[model samples]
Target chain A: MQYQATVTIEQKAGMLDPEGTTAKRALGHLGYEVSSVKTAKLYEIVLEAESADIAQQKVDEMCQKLIANPIVHNYTIELKELN
Target chain B: MKIAIIQFGGTNCDLDVLHVLKDVLGLDAETVWYKQEDLTGFDGVVVPGGFSYGDYLRAGAIAARTPIMDSVKKLAAEGKPVLGICNGFQVLTEARLLEGALTTNEYPKFRCHWTNLRVEAVDTPFTSKFKKGELIRMPIAHMEGKFYAEEKTLAELDEKEQVVFRYVDGNGKVMDSANPNGSLENIAGIVNTSRNILGLMPHPERASESILGSDDGLRVFESMADYITENF
Candidate 1:
């Protein structure tokens, strides 16, 4: 089966989000009242797997190993089976 | 003694580091491609700065997982001296060979300029030639040079004295204005627990010649040569 997985990686709660802060500041400059903004990276991957569970595990491993830094990032994985 | 300058697709600083090591320091240095999984015969390794893989998916993230990093890790574990500069520093953190992560700068811009750094830990092989508290100038070129670590990791770095350099003013005053990338505590460089591995945001290779501005950075490689002679 072919599964499509999307991984969203974001800076952990206490980690500094410079891009988010910059965007928030820009929004404030445009006269929009915005308190905070967080930034994240989304990776959409299509791979072969036996099941959705296996696909999720594979993407999770990718996030743990390369896509995300455990020290500063928290990643969420979404998987869908391709027809 | 032979040193290997790890080269990736976008590693533009390999020649500069090679020049400093071969011409300036009088050490035999070779540029090793990332595909070559062996670092045998190289006594030391220097991961020079450059946007490896075009900084895709975050700076240094892709290059950090290349096969050569396994050899680099072996050297790091065996107490061989390894220095990671600029983008190389990012790769080191991404590889988990060094603590902390180099994220986008506070203002989120690609900063490239000479910076003053105060030597904090002289015990590292890379900084052995530098005096304690000596201020040196080096160029830093990166968008994501801001180093961030957890509070506990920061505390441990302090306790272990792993911090090697901190951005500072010409007068050696540690101030926020001197911090180019808003690194935590103005840290510019750090070493691993064994003090064999070093990662810094500045480009010492760019500062090695006085004609280029200052020869202050020449000492960094010189120290490595001395270390290799004494240890290996």
Candidate 2:
């Protein structure tokens, strides 16, 4: 089966988010009343898998090894079956 | 001493380190490509600064995972002195050889200037030449040089006295204004728990000569040489 994994990686909580703050300040300048903002990277990975659970497990390993640095970032993985 | 200077693609400071070790310090230095596996017969290793792998994904992230890192890790495990300067520091952190991470500067800009650093601990091989609390000046050029670690890790590092240097002013005060990248606790450099691996943001090689404006950086190399002479 074909599965698509959507991995979302972002700075860990209480970590300084410079890019987020800059974007938030820019939004404020543009009249958006946002108090804060946090930025994240989303990766769409396509691969073959027996099931969504297996795909998710594989992606979790990927995140630990490469996709996310545990020191400063947290990540979430979502897997969807594809035709 | 035979030192291996690891050179990954985009490593611009390899030659600078080469000049400092081979030319200035009169040590035998070789530029080892990142793909090379063996690190035998080298007394020490220096990972020079530069945009390794074009700083893709994250600064030093890609380069840290290369094959040569395994050998570097092995070298470090053997208690060999492994120094990582600037981007090399990032690689050490990314490789988990050192704790913490170097993030984008608080100002979100590339900083290139002379930075004053206070040697916090001299027990380590890298800073052994400097007296405790001595101030040294070196140049730092990087977009992601802000040192960051979680509160628990920071506390542990402090407790273990793993922090080797802190950014300071001429008066030896660690003020926020003196912190170019807003590193946590003004940390400019740190060593691992074992104290064999040292990583710092400033370019000591750039300051190894009096003609280069200051010779303060030579003290670090000298300290490493002394340690090698004493132990190895």
Candidate 3:
């Protein structure tokens, strides 16, 4: 069976981020009063697994191995078993 | 001495990095596609500066998720040397091979100019060519080069002397105003706990030639060569 997993990674808040600042400024120019903005990347993966536990394990491995940086970016894996 | 420099779809500085390794340092080097999985027989690896994935989504964010990065990570885990410059630094942070994250410049602008840096730590193979407290000049061009880490982590890095470089003024003085990206502690570079992997926001390969106004950058690549020759 195959499972779908979504991983989201973002820069930690209070850390200096020039890209987010530029986006926030642009948004303000468009009449948005957002004081700050954070940037993140979302990745969806399709993988095969025998059980939910195994699926979660595979997803975690993916994140640590590639999907997310363990130091700054926090990641949460959402596993949906696909029949 | 085979060295592999990873080349992503949008990487811009692979050639320059290749030049530094092959021409300046007189080492055997080649550019490897990011999609390639094998990294055997290479003494060192470099993730050169450039807008990988066109800096889309975020700098280094997309490239970090590339298929080749897994091989880079595995090589780094085995204590092989990996150096990331500018955009490469962003990729390293995103990949978590090195500590901290690089944010946008403090000025909130894409800055392109010569940056002064102080050697904060010299124990790593990357900085072994320089003396402690030595100041070096290198070019920095990026919109997102600010480095940040948690306070405790920062303290730990200080204790371990892993902080490799910090921004400084022309007079060789460390000051907040000289900081181009408002990086915490004016950090310009860092290394992993083992010190084999290094990530710096400045481009050393760009400054390896005298016509570029400084050859200080050559020492960095040379030092790595020396380290590999002596230790490995």
Query: Which candidate has the top score in DockQ?
Result: 1
DockQ of each: 0.81, 0.78, 0.37
C-alpha displacement of B58 in model 1, angstroms? 1.5
* Per-residue lDDT over B1-232 for candidate 2, one digit per residue giving the tens place of the 0 to 100 score: 6889999999999999999988898988899998888999988999999999899878999999998999999988889999999999999999999999999999999999999989999999988889999988999999999999989999999999999999999999999999999899999999999999999999999999999999999999889888887877
Residue A28, model 3: Cα distance from true site in angstroms: 8.9
Candidate 1 chain A TM is 0.95
Model 1 DockQ, alpha carbons vs. true complex? 0.81
Judged by lDDT against the true structure, how good is candidate 3? Answer: 0.86
lDDT of 2 at B116: 91
| Candidate 3 lDDT by residue in tens digits, B26-77 | 8999999987889988888989998998887568989987778888988888
Cα miss at B81, model 2 (Å)?
Answer: 0.4
- Which residue pairs overlap in candidate 1's backbone? none
Query: Best to worst by TM-score, what's the order?
Result: 2, 1, 3
Residues B1-232, candidate 1: write the lDDT tens digits: 8999999999999999999888887889999999999998889999999999999988999999998999999988878899999999999999989999998888778888999999998888888899999988999988899989988999999999999999999899889999998899998999989999999999999999999999999999999889998998
lDDT of 1 by residue, A1-83 (tens): 99999889998887788778888889999998887999888989999998888888888888888888888789999888889
i-RMSD per candidate, Å: 1.2, 0.9, 3.5
TM-score of each: 0.96, 0.97, 0.80
Name every residue pair that clashes in candidate 3. A17-B104, A18-B104, B106-B181
**Stretches of model 1 off by over 4 angstroms after superposition:** A29-31
